[model samples]
Target chain A: MSEERIWTAALVVIGDEILSGRTQDRNVAQIALWLNLQGIRLAEVRVVADRTEAIVEAVNALRARNDYLFTTGGIGPTHDDITVDAIAEALGVPVIVHPHARAVLTEYYATRGGLTEARLRMARVPDGAALIENKLSGAPGIRHGNIFIMAGVPHIAAMMLDALSGTLEGGKPLASRTMGCWVAESEVADMLGAAERAFEGVQIGSYPFFRDGRTGANFVIRSTDQTLIDACFAQLAAQLAAAGHDVVDGGI
Target chain B: MSEERIWTAALVVIGDEILSGRTQDRNVAQIALWLNLQGIRLAEVRVVADRTEAIVEAVNALRARNDYLFTTGGIGPTHDDITVDAIAEALGVPVIVHPHARAVLTEYYATRGGLTEARLRMARVPDGAALIENKLSGAPGIRHGNIFIMAGVPHIAAMMLDALSGTLEGGKPLASRTMGCWVAESEVADMLGAAERAFEGVQIGSYPFFRDGRTGANFVIRSTDQTLIDACFAQLAAQLAAAGHDVVDGGI
Candidate 1:
């Protein structure tokens, strides 16, 4: 498993609404879950303000290291949507109006008010970019090199993701299994660490919770190999049961 | 307003669960809201893995640029909880078991299970660090220099934030007003851009939504000055109304 290549990606979430605490971001988790299914690990995520300098810096830094880089938000028709221009600056490319995007928008909005100049702004993309289908909206996502530009809206972003499912080259999907116990994770910290160290190419995460006036925790075992995960989970569960802790199968 | 000093903070969310899509992060929004009340701006946020190298890199880079840095998660008693060691490494300090923290944990677990070695792990902190009280949990948060190390649990982190309220030096709190309208943001993009440019010290962010089978958007006007925010929001709302759009005062 150590010899196997691990594909990784980074995400850049661009919005001031998030920084202002006015909106809770859902893109990071959605993209992460989607990437997990694709067998590409989400390496890191940066939530940056809607500033060109900030966007450019994050994009350049992450794109250099990861196999794929995704940016959500600031791709709309509003003036705050400066993702294309900033990405173009990052890549040292010029911004151009993509003809296919323009045609799509023209047809979609032909009946619903027609594609005005402001609406046509969605047609802009970095030079040498291809389109990612967005079934919900006329404005398509952009793909330039390994970078993907997605919508700020969750449903629209989901539509674009649906259009992109299983299209990218990825390695074996990460396998995981969870076991829950109504015991303080602190009480079992040493055991968890020992189990993790005992299993090569496997990691265990302990998440403690206080619910219904009781302390409990969920132990998640992760590895590329499902057999390893199953074996580790069984050992952990058996240890918890032996320790007189009430164990739950999935989570609390 | 431009002459007034502005305080900024960056948040580093350290968790493999978050990066793996196993958990939805609530700390970013909660801390963002709390910092807003403290008159400090959440300038940037980075979600990194539980790796010490990843945490250290994010901590060093963000803490240098911003007035304060906050890291949530990875503060538990499990072996995966390496935030203290990572930050200590970042600051070139050694980890020490704080006597005060040890006392707290001893009292807390006196009846439950006694402060065993594993439970005493909560007493570990970077040297020369002060403890931030976590009323919900005995494991106090750590505050070293301008960096605040908070708990992975949302409620514990909230308690720590509550303990530190009004303690940090900050500028005037940012003020914002939102107006919603049932119209495509694209239809009013030009007016929004023009309004923002004319507002001088204010910034307007247009967030579009598709709710209740209708297209709508909320325009948020933010500035440190309440008067500026009000003036900008009113002007934009009036402009939107005059353009034949139905406007809602506090967003739809």
Candidate 2:
């Protein structure tokens, strides 16, 4: 095996509703978790307002920088939904009614006798874009270049992205381990320093928290090597116990 | 009045823990909400990893792009906590101990038997940087150029940012209105369409949902103009009832 599978992605969360705190963005965390599980690292995530210039700038930047670019929001049947137009403009393409998307929306509403020009806004797509089939609602999302534009709603976005995940390239799993000990960070600073020096391949982190009115710290060690991770955890645990502290191993 | 009073900021969340879903970043949303109340717009947000290069890159890009850049993560009494060094590298400055920071940390720990080399990691600062006083903990955050580097923990970051908010500049608040009704989005397309055309300054959005298996949609109108928002909401209400649907003046 070549071990040549390092896929990186960037997520651009659009909409002023998120910035204003009227609506919270759940897609970034959700997609990031899913992608991490699939061995793909989410390199960067940008949450911009629904402004067209901002969207166009962000879309171009992320698309140019990462292997895959995922965007959420501004794809609904309302005036503020301008992501499609902004993306099309960024790619220097024409905004048009995608036939299949139009067909899906039209058929969906036609059966219910509610298809209107307002509802048709959901069918608009940039020219030369493919539709990402939305299993939640018949209305599909647009895909132009490396950009995968999806809905803002968590349930719908997850379903649509799930229907499309198999097609995405993934990366090697980024592994980690964390050990929490009932010792102040200062008491274990030398141990953490020595561990960092010895295990150059691993990343060691200390997070101190004041929980239950008592201060404690979690020493997290991250590395791609399973052996290094295990060895380092053992060394760290022994050191903590030697320092007269209670320690617990968290294997990930 | 000069519109120059409008201040904008960008948040750069630096941690692989967040991307891996090992930690949920409540800092960004919390900051956004707080900033919004102060009439400051958090224009953009980026979540990067613990890598020095990534942190440096994000620091430079965000600082150059926004009025202020607030970063959380990679600053602690641990080896992998390299944000200070990375930020110094980004600003092309040497990471050295600032006299004031050292004094603050030393005084902070004076009651608890004082400082050590391990705790000294929290005292290092880039040349020409000011210290962001940490009220919750002894360790202080650094402010250089346009970037304010703070801790990753939600509570600490919130407290530090709140303490610093009075000194920061703010912007005109982006206003909003919520109009909920018992009509499916498809039925009110024409109303939504008319609202969009009538209020070019405002952003009209339709969020459809299902409550107890009954369908409903909330049409939210957002703008800087209060008159336009009220007018648009009035029109939207009348149109919904005219289309044979019950209307509610506010949100759920």
Candidate 3:
């Protein structure tokens, strides 16, 4: 068997509103799904307040460990939007006005209203960075080194991820299949453990739910190898069937 | 002016489903709102996979730094539910079956089915830990030192928090007021910054939205002192009105 290399990415959600619970975060799920499509695993996520020190610390720590780092929020046109400055400090670089970003903002704002100084703040980027296309808005996302500074807005962040799709190098995507059963998780704990141990590369996650006065669980098996995933699923399903429980394919 | 102490808590979301984008996390927002009502600030959130080493590291780090640490997920009756063991390792203690938990499970499961060994696993807790009431289910939450181990289910976790309400000591709750305006955040960046600076202890967060083909934003001002929060809101509202923008009382 050949060794498989796993590409991992960490997300830093930079916003006070998120930590304060004023805003429900959708970026983590959105970005995680996007990275999975790119064959990159979203390893960890850190949600920090909109403080320069906090952002810098999380960026430095996550970037050092993961292959790529994606940050959402705090990249807006207000005083509270200080993600660029924090990232620049972490990278030991200076913040500068990117000419392309300036041009984009200037042209886009010309029809609406002239770009004021506050609006021009959206054009600032780290000293050495590339612009990620933002088809929805004029202010493009910033890509400095392996760190992608994305908008906090869920829809705009989705657009940024769509623009950068298939650009990163990654290995085979992880494949997953879910099987649901009406048996309580405790009733099949040993069976699930035995299946996981028997499978060489499959990881199973059991999620229990209480619905309609009945308890059920969905067992998700994940593996990079398709044959291994299929084998693991078949074995687990057979075990459940032998135990006199009906296994639901594709989850309940 | 007297010195004000801030009580802080950090949350560790331990689940592979959340990292895999299979589950949208509701614990962060729910716990943050609950902590705010309890007069404790939700300082940071770290989402990690259902790995023992990852859970141990995050639990130790966050619990050491913050006044309290809350962990959600991986407390179920499956092989993947190793949160209790990992936390015990982090605390340098052995996992032991709590008699009270065992009795609770035995009695609760007697009517439905006998508590088997797998079901009894829920009774295990770190050494010298206390049980938090789980009114919904038989398996109680484990409270070891300052660390709180909660269920992965959203509604169950909410019930656990309700059980813990007003139990922890905290200082004054943070007060906040939001003022909305139909102007772009960039248009009032200076005004918002000035207001935050003018108030001795106020934090202003600008959340912008695009609706009806127009740009708008809501400025949320927060402070421990009600008077300071009120002052900051008034100043910010006056500035927005002076700039020829109508200020919405609650939000746009």
Best by DockQ: 1
**What does DockQ give for each predicted structure?**
0.89, 0.56, 0.88
Residues B1-252 of candidate 1 have per-residue lDDT tens digits of 453889999999999999998999999999999999999999999999999999999999999999999999988888899999999999999999999999999999998889989888889999999999987879999999999999988888999999999999888899888898999989999999999999888888999999877888999888988888888877887888798997888888
In candidate 1, the residue pairs with backbone N, CA or C atoms under 3 Å apart (3 or more residues apart, or in different chains) clash, namely none
Q: What is the TM-score of each candidate against the true structure?
A: 0.98, 0.90, 0.98
In model 1, the runs with Cα more than 4 Å from the true position are A1-3, B1-3
lDDT of each: 0.93, 0.81, 0.92
RMSDs, each prediction?
A: 1.3, 2.8, 1.6
Q: Per-residue lDDT for A168 in model 1?
A: 85
Check candidate 2 and list the clashing pairs: B6-B171
Per-residue alpha-carbon lDDT of candidate 2 for residues B1-252, written as tens digits (9 for 90 to 100): 465466788888888777766777788778888877666788888888888998888889878878888899878877668899999999999999888878987998887657878788899988888888788777888888788899998888877887787787666666778988876776666668777888787778777776776668788887767788999888878877777876777775
Alpha carbon deviation, residue B14, candidate 1 (Å): 0.3
Off by over 4 Å in 3: A1-3, B1-3
Q: What's the CA error at residue B197 for candidate 3, in Å?
A: 1.0
Clashing pairs in 3: none
Q: Please report the candidate that would top TM-score against the real structure.
A: 1
Model 2 chain A scores worst on lDDT over the 10 consecutive residues at A1-10
Which candidate ranks first by lDDT, i.e. highest?
A: 1
